[model samples]
Target: MTPKAARRTVRIAMNGVTGRMGYRQHLVRSLLALREEGGLDLGDGTVLWPEPVLVGRREPALRAIAERHGLAHWSTDLDAVLADDTVEIYFDAQVTSARQESLAKAIAAGKHVYTEKPTSTGLSGALELARLARDAGIKHGVVQDKLFLPGLLKLKRLVDGGFFGRILSVRGEFGYWVFEGDWQSAQRPSWNYRAEDGGGIVVDMFPHWEYVLHELFGRVTSVQALATTHVPQRWDEGGKPYDATADDAAYGIFQLEGGAVAQINSSWAVRVHRDELVEFQVDGTEGSAVAGLRTCRAQHRAATPKPVWNPDLPATESFREQWQEVPDNTAFDNGFKAQWELFLRHVALDTPYRWDLLAGARGVQLAELGLRSSAEGRRIEVPEIAL
Candidate 1:
């Protein structure tokens, strides 16, 4: 008879579970779902189990989540939780403003840290965090969930297969109309519109674009951006009007290291007209692909359509139908959950994980430079960051 695999539980102290992203994606979909799936098997003689200890500022919210998930641990005191030697990992999903300080404390406590981006409010702080983590010799990671998405995965597969030979340009559109709180409650928190609260489209989305463009195509070499506050006045959660001090929309053009150009528009004020809320169209010499959060469509040079340029004639070609849908050769798990598992494995097995604090710092650097570009009305060059 085969011997049973030994189970080792890893206690993770999760902070900011009360936030929308934290509650839905991290707590419920990722961690709890992993718990339900019998944790992660290390492929050795051990199974790594995750034990979540919910920590938040609000006692009621933490207690509620613990009760809902049947979790036995809940704490409002962060220092006390950090002092607990049993807790091996500290996962933070807090807002950008609070993230740096909390992560710093966690690092100081000598705990493995994982967090959402932008890791800090500015590039300097982010670099400092990376430096601190390196000095502490603790396993640290940032959530780069898009890389694990099915659409992006398929797009990556195409890139690896050399389908898009000598990629020329990439275009991306990401946003949806976030309702102003006047008639209906805002979809996002009230703080997202206030610049003082570390809210702005450039700060919020450029970090995302940084990782995506860099990982798939090449390193971003330079950036030219125009950031604007489209909705200057907005209603708060209390049905009171407030000035939207942050940029609600950003139009950016980035030059990649390999000579490819990438353009992306991030907005909170735009209405949805595309098939997906977010989509990227990559054009190459050999082929082209359009990838969204869950779907990817492609068109090869062989199947390229030719249309006559006659302004007098009505359009006849069904351009949307010309592209073929990319097939999913394998099942894909939830991106956030997939990342969580990988980070967990990295903690347990010292597996190769690239999306560390430095990568996250690069994202923050992009956002900072993008904002600076907009402010100075000139292109800003991206410099390599070293910890």
Candidate 2:
């Protein structure tokens, strides 16, 4: 071994390795990449070196993941991994219902943590986890994958460059039809359909939208929403019909701190007719931009879109064709894998890692407020999160 390569090692213990997110994010994206490529190199021979010492899961699945990732250590005992001196960081991608318990245990064992979004199913649990992490003096972070998307990054640049002057309102359309778990076998896990498992569109996706909204426009102040369950029943892993008790779709309007307005729609059962599944439209005094999943278009006041009631007008010249594709400018990779690299650098090199627990709590806060608004049939003011 090279003298410099043996100097530092950041041991990691990953919890919940059997599930979908666990397999994709932890095993394939994070741990495997770290082991094979030696972690992401920050610069000047400095590298974020990760030593995945323990991966926790059920017995059979744990063994499979160990063999898959070529990991030497595996366990089903959370406490054992936490107690190991070789493990310095604890990562969790468990279901939202179990996130709080796993995180609390990890913190008590005195290890830094990084976990998936919606830190918890509700505001209270999320707040408690944030407090524990702070009191324990351990660095904590949550996955905000949307912030790293190539399309969103380009949009951020436009906003920063004053392309959208004094933004007036923002609109977002996010969703795609998931399987009914019978004929198609359910694209998402069965746990997502169970309210008890913290599975709901609002909780799963609002956290992602929160960061994007805050990043593009500003902080959200008030939210009014309506939530629904389009699919009442879905098949479980065992291929039996189970009644879905969670909201599968949600429509909401948010008032930003700066008086900017945003309308967001999230769904798991909807057919999309757009270029990409997700799209965002931002309007400003000087200009407006329509950002589809893969494309973005800017319109100045001189070129502002016009509307007509007359059916004679020739199909409103396909504006989609007029827009140019925004190029990805950031050097960092995209998606969850990219976030993994950034988090590793943040831990090892003290790089600017602002995606912390408080940001995550903000997401949970929004979800809680949305649910309340829907249930009360009125607009709800979002409470300020105390990080």
Best by the lDDT measure: 1
- Report every candidate's CA lDDT: 0.94, 0.82
TM-scores of all candidate predictions against the true structure: 0.99, 0.93
Tens-place lDDT per residue, model 2, 79-146, is 88888877888998888888888889988998889999889877888889989999998888998877
Worst lDDT 10-window in candidate 2 = 1-10
Off by more than 4 A, model 1: none
Best by TM-score: 1
